[model samples]
Target chain A: MSTPARLQPGDTIGILGGGQLGRMLAQSAAKMGLKTHIYCPDPGSPAFDVSNTFTVAPYEDADALDRFAAAVDVVTYEFENVPGPTASRLHAKVPVRPGVRALEISQDRLFEKQYLTKASVDIAGFAEINSQEDLDQALQKFNGKGVLKTRRFGYDGKGQLMIRSSADGNGAYAALGSVPAVLEQLIAFECEVSVIVARSLDGTCVSYDIARNHHENHILKTSTVPAGVTAETLNTARRMAEQIVTGLEYVGVMGVEMFLLQEDGEERLLVNEIAPRVHNSGHWTQDACLTSQFDQHIRAVAGWPLGSAQRHSDAVMENLIGFEADEWHAALSDPNACLHLYGKSETREGRKMGHVNHIKAKALTEGET
Target chain B: MSTPARLQPGDTIGILGGGQLGRMLAQSAAKMGLKTHIYCPDPGSPAFDVSNTFTVAPYEDADALDRFAAAVDVVTYEFENVPGPTASRLHAKVPVRPGVRALEISQDRLFEKQYLTKASVDIAGFAEINSQEDLDQALQKFNGKGVLKTRRFGYDGKGQLMIRSSADGNGAYAALGSVPAVLEQLIAFECEVSVIVARSLDGTCVSYDIARNHHENHILKTSTVPAGVTAETLNTARRMAEQIVTGLEYVGVMGVEMFLLQEDGEERLLVNEIAPRVHNSGHWTQDACLTSQFDQHIRAVAGWPLGSAQRHSDAVMENLIGFEADEWHAALSDPNACLHLYGKSETREGRKMGHVNHIKAKALTEGET
Candidate 1:
């Protein structure tokens, strides 16, 4: 916790959870002359392929954490699922960017909502249920038509259930095996969007352009830039994101997802969730902006200035899920598509294999209302 | 080589050089789920750090080449200076994308000029210097202003001398130290530019927008987009570059350097040199366009369609020579700048250690052209 606010080049960056985000974060670090040591339980994680050092040990492995912490200058994590013991352990020795508090809140949806409420960030109407009886009470309060999601270890549609009616709500809760859940009335809205913002120790916060996002079965599918949001909405979205970062004293990049609710021409942004690391919606920045979220995360973690976070081109980013990644050759051959295929060997269903970014000159279209 | 054009995932790509370009090319290849085996003489070469396999023997090492060929699907190199025998030996075993013919022509400055001239591409005035008598004759013809350069292995202003007056010309021949050389009349040009065109094995060529480049001490300092040239000059540069690529049946990214000469208030392009691989000027494309030159090179060599070479942003790319790369942290912190550091551990003057690309929106400004 006592680590310096800024990191210099040649410093070792200790990263937890070697997922695709960590893989990319390590690559960006390498490009900035900073070394990365990835600590993940999987020996075969894609991040190891590009890192200078990798430790294959469980999160509870204190010996491994000690060695990893002693070896690196700073620690950051790609995922927010670190156990309390793991987070507390790492924080005791090495300075963890985004800190254990951010991790604790983000790792659990209930805690995250509580933290958001404390920060006065707006969210959709919601209720927490620790048991089926609590679920029944929430259903009674919200009229039972809601989305029920688990309290922890959930992402990309996992641990989520939708209730269409009272009977369906009861059935959904039972289907989930009565796990501790949070139920929220789904916003009957227009679009899903996200803002990738970075906060430095100096409180310098910069947000990227809004991204109009589409999800399939709760998994991110595509993100289009110059999101057809009003100027006021865009500014408000940035403000809301800045408020969240400022409240958390967050370091590195964080993605804040929001739902655009349009009712009687009154548009509102309802906070959906926060991704503690780089989000899929921001992948368009790799080719469409001056600096990518990965590069910005590297810069922030390295104590470098957050880049312009400006979009240089109108862009479309499509995720390579499942067999979609198999079209890599086809994507590479398309002179119009900038393909980013994750080095994963297998293309399992619903798995994020990679993405393709198509950047084009901004087309002059009639302004959206 | 009986390898199919459509390579499946998990294939191995053999790269012939170990420089930063090769390193970047390897990174792209790895991202596409393909393995790379770097063949470079230097053990400390950066590419070796990121590849799955590597051969530390020189290009002329027959055992190494044969083994390298045996270990991979196809072969590609990042530089033109690869000796003919080395390319021939490698080509004998695998399909060499861009082919050995490109290497043969570009490896020698004199041969490159002769090839371009023979192909009907306009080139600067030149004469071969086989003897001191020939140098004097060329000097007399020049009325005494020319650049005498060794015919081979000259880069970054090395192995070159300028002859202005009679006395300087007298000592110039001895200065070359008896190496075969060529004397070229220095043309007064308004600007220097380069066209990076990629040719697929099927003879499909796609050209990137011409970039106006600046050089310091004969080494490239910065390259900016929307080269300060007219639309007419852009077309002329592309056509001249296409002529050379077509003539050689070259595949992969080739950089054709040209002099934009203004004679009597009319602009024209003179072919100066050709680089058979990705050029530094195109580095901005990584962030400014949908597909980067390195990714394009990987696609081209893999027998894939060359990705779109469109420019969506105006970019300024500065090569970090030697200690300049040490500014990685400061550069990374610049919101507008994307720092790219080649993992070269040492710093030496004039050596291109890495580069930073600063990009901005490419909207047309109010102007009268």
Candidate 2:
């Protein structure tokens, strides 16, 4: 295929989904003199505040999607839950970065695992579950301990049921609404980590340093950069992310979450899952790195050259969920803290309201592995 | 007066002047979960693209101003050129930050110099002139070399004429429209620098490190942090900014420009003027400091505590005037560069199209003085 001309600064980039991520993405796009048109069903979407225009419509609205695609030079998204047909239709008109393959694989847990397995990338053993019998068989492989997640439409630990023992198999299967699912073996890991990588249209790829994550209530609470993993393990993780991005022929930023397993003096990383867009774990980059992941994603989607993913500072990023953002007053006075609040209309439980990045110059020693 | 209640995350801030500065201010406000309403006469003002709502009407439009004030919780402006009556009207309806005093002082150069002198701040030898005779008298004090500038409504080297000798006094006066003006003695200065400071509603103050500025064609071309100045110079600059903010009882961010003159191996600073809002020289703070000047402005105007103004990196900020922003492709791939472009549709000569901040960790050695 012939390479399309790179988008000029004045080009309009159409974004699918309207959330904090899209809001930040739109801001980054604006910083490059690029206009954004966000298309989302929610009129109160935070991204609407920062974009040039927006279309309030369901993702499945073909007419709206067609108009949106035709109006912009390129298309990208803030989340992977976009309907396949909607993406396919948009792709038929304008280029969609991260490509449809990445979205298709990321939306379905089974497809993600299958792709990783095919690439020889290490992942937790997973079995497809279409019925109670499949769950029963899958439980035997995990010694009756596993997580049954719906093949599609899962996020923030939702759409997944954990099986602690064989007795919970049938109930767990039913909890998934009897939908097609994948059973992932429960792995006792040391900690969770993620790598945000960006791939330009020319196939050049760059990954940020790994981010060590801590989750509460199935939602990420904090992410610290320089993950405290050994150089070997970090390198392995970066290579894995690059391999995945390459396999998908991606042309935008992707977050690959992993489980870092400590085994004696060695550390092993198991691919947890992939988010085919800027991920929460990468938020630290906004304050710690010269080129933020949002900026990198915009560059990639615009077919511009990829930016350096090197971080300039060590940082601890903590998310403010729901009313926790009420502490914004304290953050305001913090000399080392960089606060970013989504223009959310209300504070809801488990809802990400904002985040704070407390940065320190790199002179501070990295965390001990 | 009882301290006005601190603005909450969902509060709206009404901004006057929908330029690039307002655009950045709006983005910063959104990052704090605050909505912004921009009011400007220019329908194509860049800020409208990022704000939640905007009014394309003259500042003197009482109906539009009243409606805008009613819609927002508080009012702030991006430039000092705001009409004093417009500010008073807004202040009467909603709290206008930095207050009308800041606008009244900063809009007129004579008032600004008078305020600084009253505050015991050092300033260039200046004399108010209403005619050619006044200009000739002012020239006598400066050895016939000085700059004649309109006392109000002047920016970017506009509305000013150079008086190189007493013989040119009449022509200089006519060149300035024979209007009331200020004649400033031309001081052979080493360099120009600026200090950006913020003051909260409760009187808390914070200031960023000095920014050394370079001008071309009387327009700021670049700003470098750390200023390559003595520690004493930096401290004095900070103190001057603090004194000015306190003197004005300002409740928002302000930029104080000064000339650094080296005499007998000692640096003496002469106050040039004040910008009663975010200044172009402070653009480097976005990449070099923990909290950007725009972020601090929003916080102070919203009655929130001033954020930390600590610098974590050394940076050089270069402006992209007009067509120079077409080099965006180079900035896209640069690892150490952070680019910020105003969403301007056209590139006019001398128009501030964007800026690029190249930063390095503080561990890097400072440049030679």
Candidate 3:
């Protein structure tokens, strides 16, 4: 829970990253009569196209940061990669929603694991892989198989490597630029799910229906709503998300990724990662709920009450990767689809250009379809 | 029916007249990955806040019009006030949707009435009022009550006068500077409703669910959806909307105002006026349907098939008029409400600064006591 600072409708909401998520956030902010000023380093960022006000300088540029801080009423970011120093700088000047402490835990895998451990949250077996000897020791303990991820600055299957045996552990450690890393025992999880929760500065929190995601080639392919799970598993997922966010005193929307693991007849949830801002998996909120996660993020950061996170219908969100956005018109003509384009000019493989959401009532005879 | 041309994603859709409607239309265009270039006389027009490009010059500025037309694929205006010469200037270069002919008729009330009449559409009885003698003659045939409106331009109850008596007519005519006017015998009506119809170049027509309007101080106060009309009336509204569009060979979206008259024991509809572009009455489409009227207009003008005009939910949209915008914060706090601001700097009395749309399930049982 954080201070309950109220914001008026015309308040300027400051966004720190300038990707599709931030672009959507700015759009949502404008829709609610709130102005948005985007602060990002990329001079050609897509979000800048829609937002009239922006600072085109690096996050660490003090002059630009100061100007951005002075212009906006509240500050929030689209990604956890926001360096802790930059967050601290802005927090000193403006009400930085989600706060600097949340960034500290999310920016580093080690810090995230440490926070989860102190909260008695479940996680895969792991250890810090610093020295070559440390990798060997962890590899032997985990049946000679484990994943080594950079302690900080890793995303989208980058800055991480899987080592099946100690034979490649030495090579895998170097593949990570020989940086300080966290080693984790790989879990054969049955499925991956995410809970997107919005916690306002007033301590009010609302969680959307969990979504089961399927990734292809290390990129999110599709996400289905009403993720089939027992009531106990659903409640556990919600409680785990609440505990992590409340413990971090986070504000705005936060996504907690988890592994749905099953062993014989036993089933439980395991913490995978945490996003301090809105997650791609929650894109379904734009069509399936009364309020979208991006809109909820703006509302929460603006000191407005958290909106209904309840799902209105079963939904599926498919990411338009690379040139897949070329089929936008066809998707738009589909009676069951709502297409969204990010207005990005450049197209390259694996770049998330846009997404589409389909909301429909879940079939009554649903199994594992 | 004009030839339907395929407009791929990222095509430019040029819009003339940069008022609030154009501002909203530009935003909807950006959401679809389409570029919008707003051409308007006022440099401070609100639509410039969201459009990618803009040209600020008078409508008669041929140099500006040529550049505007050359820079975009198709041209449409936000208001019918677009002069005939300006439409011709653009039409000579770019293919203007809902072309100059429609613009000329819409800008002048006399031409609009004549066209509708030629199409066998029913309308309130009216006579031309030019001189004092003509006013006296019109008053004689008025059956003791009438409304006189300027034939060139009138909106939101402006440029129109109520002729309660011949004595009042002199004062009204004098106030109007005795401009060319049309006199209409006042008719008793049940409710005021508007039909927003979209017609593609190929004559693919689609009309949104009718919007029942409530006026306060002669300005639109609220628009309610589902209009709560009999099936027969609804079908007629759609058919009439289509007929008017097809008659003019109009492309893009046009708003047709119709009077719902319950004369004797039967209900009838009368042609009132037409807006040759995206309209305020259709603002509810943003929240109440899968496809917004503004987006539908861009689609049609871009030569794309019209999206479904399905009403996703019954809605009530209320304008935050004048100083009523002072309650913006309260409106933003409502979970059931969606607020949209025009980004206008001033909020004088009777000026439309913003609007709020509330979409809820239709009150299934009428007269619930």
Whole-model lDDT values for every prediction = 0.82, 0.87, 0.82
Q: What does candidate 1 score on TM?
A: 0.94
RMSD of candidates 1 onward, in order: 3.5, 3.7, 4.8
Per-model fnat list: 0.46, 0.52, 0.23
Task: Give the alpha carbon lDDT tens digit for every residue of B180-258 in model 2.
Answer: 9999999899999999989988898888889899999989999987788877888898899999999988998999999
- Quote the lDDT for A278 in model 2: 97
Q: How many residue pairs clash in each candidate?
A: 4, 0, 0
Report the lDDT tens digits of candidate 2 across residue range A198-228: 9998899999988899999999999987688
Task: Give the DockQ of candidate 1.
Answer: 0.43
Off by over 4 Å in 2: A1-5, A170-175, A362-369, B1-5, B362-369
For residues B1-369, write the lDDT of model 3, one tens digit per residue: 222266666778888888788888888787777888999888888787777888899888877788887788888888888888888777777788877888889888888888988877778898887877787788888765788899987888889888786678776666777899888888889988899999987898988888899999988899988787766877888898899999999988999889999978787899798888888889988876667898788878877777767665667899999899988777766776777887777779988999998756322111111
lDDT of 3 by residue, A231-338 (tens): 678778888888888888888899889999987877788989989999999998887666789889988888888766655556789999999998787776665577
Q: List the residue pairs that clash in candidate 3.
A: none
Q: Give the TM-score ranking, best first.
A: 2, 1, 3
Candidate number of the best DockQ: 1
Ranking by DockQ: 1, 2, 3
Descending-lDDT candidate ranking = 2, 1, 3
TM-score of chain A of 3: 0.95
